[model samples]
Target: MIERILEQSKALIHVLSADRRTRHLVLTWQDTEVLESIHKTLHPLQEFTDALSGEEYVSISYLKPVLHLLKTKTLAEDPVDTDLTKSIKSRVIGYLQDKYNDPITQELLDIASFLDPRFKTNYIGKENIPAVKARMKAKMEEGTRKEKRSRVRDTEFNSLT
Candidate 1:
């Protein structure tokens, strides 16, 4: 919405400024500057939000990589950013870091992404890879044992019948 308005700003500003009743609604230069800064700061986040919202494509494993991209590329402060844009970027980066900084949460993400074939170990921290691998091994072995026990039980029941 803001993008569209900004795109047609010249025409819209002329129309709004020309009308007595709507003249009061015309955005001042300062207001447009602030709005433009805000729009620029937040525009990159929309793609991340939309990608994460999808059930078919998104998975828990995507969160860590997406956050990494957000901090390193999408939300990084640019040299040309206005003060307001820089501040907004900083707060968003800070929020994402704090939100995912918990030890358990980090481990969960590491394990999930590591288990995923498409990303296995690509995004996992070097320090975390060993632990995540160990957990996956344990789980796979546990599943194998359970399967063996179930097969044995079925065989015993079939023999009795």
Candidate 2:
């Protein structure tokens, strides 16, 4: 009888441990789903980076398409979604908006994108193109002015010598 009781207790412990493991897995399954979605959405972007040269790959313009893709993927409803997943998605959107939504940065990205012959403002919206072009023109003028000033300084120094 003692041996039978010991065997029953061992079985009970095994069952309880299994139940605890199942509960842990159930609780954490949502995290796994979120991570899997992130991996799936970003894997292609990673592969794209591998195909680009250093300069093109690191440009701020690359963030536009990547952010678009990530927003599209992460904002969609998922079967196993949880609040944590939603929070992560919101944080990503917020971060991108905070870092790149300003006019100056947007203008810079537009200029960089426009300078790339492969794109050349083709991807920029019609409404924004005029403003971006204006900003680009202003920047070019500023550069030229600085260059002229530097040249004048150089001539003055040469004359003094």
Candidate 3:
């Protein structure tokens, strides 16, 4: 699936590059620079996605680091043209923020990160650590309660039988 997506993107890039009229109009140095920047940013994500595709269970914990990487890479790209780079960066940042800035989604990502032994609170901010830990505790307690309820139901059914 990842390979297919990448191939389709490449085909689109090829078509855009090949166009006679719009090609000359759109393929400025700044445009090329922006495309390169986007490509560089996406390559690692493609690799990560491929890696995750092989897994039986891909945890939401992966999202936090992937979001971090996207932000970091987009910011790190050198501005070939200040105005164009700023515009591109602003658009990308706005899209990410709009999609991922919900409190519930952030809390879920933070809890996943906190629960993963490999990450544990390492990637989480100091300010969010306490909140994430609290959320984790609540989730564990909820699971315990559910399990107890299930066992009680099973025991009651067995007794009735």
How does each model score on TM-score? 0.92, 0.52, 0.61
Lowest-scoring 10 consecutive residues by lDDT in candidate 1? 50-59
| Whole-model alpha-carbon lDDT for candidate 3 | 0.70
On lDDT, the candidate that comes out on top is 1
Give lDDT tens digits, candidate 1, residues 1-161: 98888888889989998989998888789989988998998887898788788878747888889988988888887899899999999999999889999999999999888877888888989988888888989999999999999999999999999
Residue ranges of candidate 2 with Cα displaced over 4 Å: 1-57, 69-95
Clashes of each: 0, 0, 0
On TM-score, the candidate that comes out on top is 1
After superposing candidate 3 on the true structure, give the runs of residues whose Cα lies further than 4 Å from its correct spot: 1-56, 77-83
lDDT of each: 0.89, 0.64, 0.70
How much is the lDDT of residue 33 in candidate 3? 59
What is the per-residue lDDT of model 2 for residues 99-119, given as tens digits with 9 covering 90 to 100?
888988777777777777767
Residue 78 deviation, candidate 1, in Å? 1.5
Candidate 3 TM-score to native: 0.61
Model 3 lDDT per residue over 61-144, tens place? 777877777787644456563555556666766787899899888878888887777788877879999887786788889999
Model 2 worst lDDT window (10 residues): 1-10
